[model samples]
Target: MKKLFIAAILFVSSSCIKVIDPESNYITGDQLASSADALAGMVRAIPVRLVNYQNDDAGIEQCSYHGMLSMLEMMTTDMVVSGYGGFNTTSAYTYGNLSARGSNRGIYPFYMYYGYIKAVNDVIGLIDSETDDTTLKHYLGIAKAYRALFYMQVGAIYEYKAPTDSRYTEYYVAPEHDLTELTVPIVTETTTGLDVKNNPRATFDTLYEFILSDLKNAETLLADYTPSSKVYPSLAVVYGLYARAYMEMASHKNATENYMQALNYAQLAITTSGCSFLTEDQWLDPKTGFNDMTSQNSWMLACSISEGNTDGQGGGFHHTMLFGTETTYSSYGWRVGRSLNRKTYEAISDNDFRKLSWLGPDFFATETHYDDEAGKWAYTLRSADDTYVGNYRLTSDPQWLRNRITVANGFLAMPWIYPGIKFRCYAGNYTSRYPGCATDLPIMRVEEMHFIKAEAQYHLKQEEEARSTLKEIMNHRITDSSYTCIASGENLLDEIMLQKRVEFWGEGINFFDAKRLGLGVDRGWQGIGYSRYQGTYDIDGIAFFWTIPFPTAEEDGNPALQGYNNPYMYNTAMFTYQSNAALSQYYGIPPSYGN
Candidate 1:
């Protein structure tokens, strides 16, 4: 998918500026409101490029065999369309990279939130700068909420390992927003250029204190105001944000309570937003088929490419899912959607939606939406700077033939191209190419909310209620509960986590949920893994946290003294092994997660 449309107007300043001149530039009240909105949108945007693998106690999971993207590929490969280029790698590296930088990943935050901090601070300035409180409190509330959110993401993914105990320490802090700089840190306070380094890191206490303050303030601001749009952070998202913050603190008592608070807010969001769980009939709708038309269920979503969402790069209907098929884009350049391991592959029920895969005799033009916009997916001749122009064809590579031909569905192209089951947005003609037309990316949905509620209740031993909730999701999602497993006792938690993992594969919930619950990723065994929209993958090893790239390279040779780039390395001999369990053929994983 083309994610380049989030609308950050990047212009090279004559030189980086530090020490704000109130006259030269300062965020205003209106800017504060606008930036608050942008902050929400950017939060959703940050994760698209990265995946978290923490498991709290749930087993951790991740894919690190591939090299870091932003650090290397952006400087090297023109492999964006392949879904394995700089963007993916950059976002994927956000956790570690930002941590090393003493900040959040990518320029996304700096680019999106500096303006935010400015906006909020400006709002505060506006309140005191002016007379009546009026809406200033409201906007202030929003600004604070957004501030807490960005900090939470930065804190959880970047902070030094948990104190091993939550005794507040410097490690727990999120980088402080140079509020005067707003979200943009003044060069004086920030490391600029590549090698400068020397920016201050916020202590864990500082980060949490700020987050708590914001959420508490936001709760008051939101007390009476009922937002007309669910897209905005209704009270629910605030609670969700609070739960997220508490979890980062490892304050289970608080975290669990906040999670429940989140659920309440989620429920409110549904009522106010008109969102609902995916019904059996609407689970995989074709066009604007799914009930994705902003409802209470939509905690977050990138607007459809058709609807003008610039959130992802070249919206490609999430083509990275299907491996071994022409329809799946994993075959493009970067080798994503690599085949699933035997264990995970075997764990999938033949009846499960992900196991199915297909290709046609040749690619076609059936996909009208993507191709029409695709300059080429539409088959327009290359005007001039055509990289593959006259250089490749549907028949040019046998890998093409192998990738294109499928044994199922008469091996015929739909309309004219291939389509994956879960991700219905087609990538258009195999002969011609363009970014695929996937749906507005989902941030959260009733289905997952259902699972969260189910799991949370289960942990509290709301056994029967949890079981009932779990069944509601399965039956509502599939038409039959038989498709799901309902093991109690030792495996109950595993059962709940697996349901969530398979249900929300590429949507970005897995790693965090797994971490919070202390569930173990099935490097093998039943929870191994599967894919439909993303393609198959055997669990290589259970990685709980993203080994974010050490942006030492980006930070080196700079006056800012930005980061000490940490290489992506894990010593395997130290990993624990399930001595009695069998390991799958998929390589790189050690027997178990270890200290």
Candidate 2:
């Protein structure tokens, strides 16, 4: 699949920037400058091209930008994917095959992002920058903002710093193999094929400078523009992108000034967006939970997935994350679906409303504690050999677990102990079995701005302000009225990050967070929570596996990437198994469930 995609990419042109279709006659620059509708259509296609474009030949449901990147990002962290589902294809990430450049998962993002970048560049190239047309300026701003967003993702994933660099030594252990700092090559409107052939990865300073410039341009052009849908980039979304870029920049350079910029932009986004946090009822809504972006004021940017338009076939975000839907892959008993790390799960206070997002290990024992009158439990025990054994029905406030039975006669009925129910399938009819994969996925929510603000406040030494910000989010998430964030210093930062982790679980933001914070993957220690393949190993200091290698196709085609690619760490034994205990005991599961 990767080779096929790469072949197609190469067939179009030798350069990544020329991924646009060569066979079709493209509209000339003069035509685009004169035609408002054509230009508007191109601007509209930017988000859809990146987020909603379907590539079935990839043979993975995660072919879309959000789906592919989210899967890859989550797999790199403590998030667990069940071996029983189609997501098992991404297990390479869990097993520390991050350098599998030929693999579909490894190259998909590189292909997708660069392809999307080319499309955005075409729109930008056709438009005259000096034009007085407000609408053209708005269109240009949207294109630039998306370009910045895509570049930020690329830089976050592929950027590397050498051990000799003082900044690298401060945050990470020196890898056994020598490496040099590198970001993806910058391609823009005027970047020709000859220029791309000689394009070397940009330095961190160079890459981020370009990103900030694009965002600044976006900010000015979008000053008077308002988008009707959350799908388009609004002024607030641009501010959020500024926050995102600066945060990533701070992580790489360890600059206090960058942190200040991130802090400022985050606060700007919060005040300007006018988007409120998700109410407790909205957060846990069984029918519309995390699916309907239109009804939720909290979502700042989202992509709507309607029926017949999804990257489905059991591979989309809804199919992989939401287990309660009967039509999805996670509903089957044999599939483990998406589960939480037990350590992280245990960290949440029992009273925290978010704790209800996952099924407790002892859910079977605690079934009676929940109110049945509210239709919380989606399934019930009928008989030992009942046909409805795996059938699940939607209810008003259904909890994580589908059924009540732990053991059905001689069979151990329950499969995943901590499968996530935070992201539920769209439920127009509460009783409908065929919910389909039509859940609208959130790209950015206002709640994230709150988190970004809190962390930046902590880094800026505004301890009291940081605590208040953390408390503000916690007060909403935790049902306890008296709860406060009292942790000071590094612990306070940890509390902020922990809450962020819990808040954005299965949302694909954690991998970047962990990388930026210089945290290691510690899933192999005793009492670890990861199940299956990821349970056996830990990476101390920094998990360089999180550093993705440039796809082999990119390296092969681009002369400048040859011998300068990110080091392949798979054979280095970078990840080691530190525990000798039985797998079941390591996972804290009972011995009856034989491993």
Candidate 3:
């Protein structure tokens, strides 16, 4: 696969060069360099490569950024899946398998980001930075910003920080086993296979420096370039990137300076983006909720998925997340359907509109029908007239409940509890047998910047300012006028994080936040939704399993990484677990509920 990828890169490079002799069908790099259209085409292709490129070697069509990585990241967090059929058997439930070098869980992300980085490098290598062509510079800025984004994501995933580190001591009990600090190898446009063979892992300081440098260049280059679509990075998006990078850096190093910078950039993004918070109507729209980028002004950057362009046969984000839609993986036998963590769901206040994202416990207070022949209990909701409607109202407005949580007929008999209805299908295409997975997934939004600003303020000792910022977003989310944040000190920080978690649930942002803040996984408690066979476990900060190991292929090919690979955590029991009987006794949910 690596060789094939390298060959494809060479082919793309050859095809893009200038065709000096039309008869010969050969082109020179110099000729391709002067064409602004060519540069733009290259820059545009980077997103497609990052989000949609399929790796056939992985034996799954879902080996792309949106299809696999996002879903996998969500699985590691508070997101819970019904343990019926094939869902419990997947690695998402058994996180120990994530450390296996041969596992696609590791390979998919390792290849996806590096593949994107190589493509971005191809574009960056062609542009002459001093050139007077504004068009070329615009493309260059976007490419650099994207490169920084990929590096930030990959670096966060692969780097291993010990729980014993001074930064994390307050949040975690140090694990019995400790590992060295390291990030992935640095690859560039000028790098050769020989260079790769000898390249060692980069230090976190070095990685952070490289990321900031790219964003700095991007910020300057994108100063006057106004983007026509949110798909491309603009000045605001660059500022958001700055905010994100500084926030991540502040997690461990130079907290005072980094958090202050994070706060400034986040405020800049919120003010300059020309985007506003999504009103209740926009957020909960049944047809276009979180599916259409143009439907709301909150989205700053997104990967636009069009019909027939994304994988619709159960590999895309919509296929896995939208249970309300028919023909999606979640709706078909509830095979891979996901639900909100009971603990997290219960944490949300009744007055908060975000709580409506998941079905309430009242939705499960319906009669059960036993299928004698199938030997399973089918859960169904009935109306006052005893007609099967599959509807349950949590609010006085029946139309509001009907619009967001409409379930397919096939799913009416399933026993999945508290399944999330936040991500809806495009155009309310719930009855169609064909998969309508054309939901534009958000990469960055102004809503996130508000949370970043609040967190930064809290870290910088501006407690009152932090409370105001938190209240600003909460006021927009909570319809109740009584809602106020009076918490101070550590409690104030917790409030800010809780709001952020609720706001970004299932969006793949929580895992990074959890890792950076050194929060442990505590899914074994009562009222949680983790499966029994998976066994509820409490892992300390820097869950070693969460730090993905370098793929076996990379280690074997790159000699320098053989001895220096991140620790193999599959054999190491880095977490403590309660017995199956204890878990079942406390949680009360059966393995295959109603089976």
Candidate 4:
């Protein structure tokens, strides 16, 4: 799973330089440009630093990016945290206990992405001064693309966009704030330490402009560059990143023009990369699912997991989310990982292959059963693949026994099981205390392009075109050609959103999408079960709760962030209810609760 291993080298400079980020140091521009090898090493350092999210401060409990995704996923109605008693579990955020000073929550990602930005800026400085070589220009492109991605992610959380956010009215900073009004602090390669330390946050428009500028530069530079691996930014990822960036900016600017551009760039990424949709079999393949990076033609970019990979603070996706153990790593216990809400699980058509990502009543009743002979389920429900079907014996401390029993009892009462088998563990293949949780984490893929294009087309009032595009994605996942999405009754936009929710599920885009579209999350009803994951799924009463709170630590340190944090809104009561009636309507039958 590990790709491009490079030993860390320190580049120290005595020369004075401006620092733009708090974590950046005195590595001078001259020192960075002095050696091409040094610059390349620094470039290599970008991804190396990016993958590590472990903080000894938080007991190495979370990886910044993955943990951010975990919080977002858990807070949404679709994904649920099943592990009730795990240390520093996401349950607090899932139940709407997010605080301005929450430990290992927003602070970790804020520092993580900014730290990445600082490293990227260092590379950009070197590239700007010393790089005329075509290869170096490609590295420049990579740096810029990554910078744009970080900005987009950070901006998505902090900045309030009026078009998408209903609580924009409550924001102290104006959505129409000019270039001088700070939204996110702008730190570039040219930014000096003094300037960075005292820099004011840029306005919403200014932040978007800065992000788009980086993407534009990257797109131009990477156009002809053939990428060595999917882990690095290819020309395709550049385009895809542009498409994603434009989609976010589209609402603020020329909606029609930006949507068209978003669609165009997405198309370019697909056509230029020769990436195709995963076949039905690949979709159903338990061994691969969403985890296998190389085999899926749709994968445009992924994070690699290597042997002895401690990049995730010794916790890979398996530790944070995977429910059952394949290898020796502690699993918290089966039925105690993340889970898709039963209402959301039931919305997918029975024939659709993606439906199998989560286990439902059908899986328990027909496809799998308790192996009385082995005193375990015939297969580890960790993945859908029959090859992965085997007993999961506890080789570690069985202290998790009581909790495991509790989860097992809850599983029987719930309609569907979650923390879906989408991410499979490398059990039989490798084993060590921290054996590579070697599942490749996906960043961008071609399947997303189809969804983005459909959403843009729909927004443009090209309903039929949107339906056609939706059908293109649906046709690949469903065997029935007779299926057609209608523009009536349930509405085409909702149907498209539903498909997106189903497609992206645990991938973490649903939360952002739900917020952008001004859609309130409704997890139907808290089930009869007593599990945390099965509770009432709603965070309604909190206005703008979707906007992540600015870490109090950040505000105290940076004078620029004072009074600019998104206001915290508590859930005094559940906001709205999305009934199973719509889900039943989609499947054309009332979903069975259980046996």
Best by lDDT: 3
Q: Give all TM-scores, in the order shown.
A: 0.55, 0.82, 0.83, 0.79
For residues 358-429, could you state the per-residue lDDT of candidate 2 as single tens digits?
665444332222235752222233333333211122343233223432333111223324656666666743
lDDT per prediction? 0.37, 0.64, 0.65, 0.60
lDDT: worst 10-residue window of model 1: 72-81
- For candidate 1, the per-residue lDDT at 253 reads 44
lDDT, candidate 4, equals: 0.60
Q: Which candidate tops TM-score?
A: 3
Candidate 1 Cα errors over 4 Å, as ranges: 1-142, 162-206, 222-231, 246-274, 289-335, 338-402, 405-421, 426-439, 481-486, 518-550, 553-568, 571-595
Candidate number that wins on TM-score, 1 or 3: 3
Which scores better on lDDT, 2 or 4? 2
lDDT of 1 by residue, 1-595 (tens): 1111112311111111124345545443345335555444333322222211111111112211011111212111011111222223333221122333333333232323233343344334333323245455555565566667656553443333321212222223332222111111122111233313444445556667777887887777766656544334545556556545544454344555655655555455445445566543344433322214442244443223222322222322232222213343444212322222333333445454443321211222222232335322222222223233121122124343433333232221122222223433333222322334333344445565566666666655666777777777766544545754557754776677666766754344554554344343232222221211111111222232332332343344332424322223322222223321221121222113230
Writing each residue's lDDT as its tens digit, candidate 3 over 1-595 gives: 0111223233231122121333444344466666666657677777655445544554334444555445455434466653342443344424545643554555667776777787788788777778677888888899999989988888988888654333333444333334455788888767876999888888878888888899998998999999877888999999999999999989877999999999999999988898999888877777777778899999998876556553432344343343442223343223444566666676677877777777654554365555668554444543434332233212123333333233342222133346666766667665442444566768898999999999999999999999999889998898676679899998998889888888987676777887788766655455354444353455556554567677888888888787677655443233234444444333433323421
* Cand. 1 TM to true fold: 0.55
| Alpha-carbon runs more than 4 Å astray in model 2 | 1-26, 53-62, 82-87, 161-179, 308-334, 365-416, 428-435, 571-581, 589-595
Q: List clash counts for every candidate, in order.
A: 74, 0, 2, 15
Off by over 4 Å in 3: 1-28, 34-36, 58-60, 75-77, 83-85, 88-94, 163-180, 310-334, 366-416, 433-435, 571-582, 588-595
Model 4: CA > 4 A from native: 1-27, 55-64, 82-88, 102-104, 161-182, 311-313, 316-328, 332-335, 365-415, 427-436, 488-490, 524-530, 533-543, 571-595
Candidate 4 per-residue C-alpha lDDT over 22-80 given as tens digits, one digit per residue, 9 for 90 to 100? 33433455655667787777776666554454444433343535446656666666765
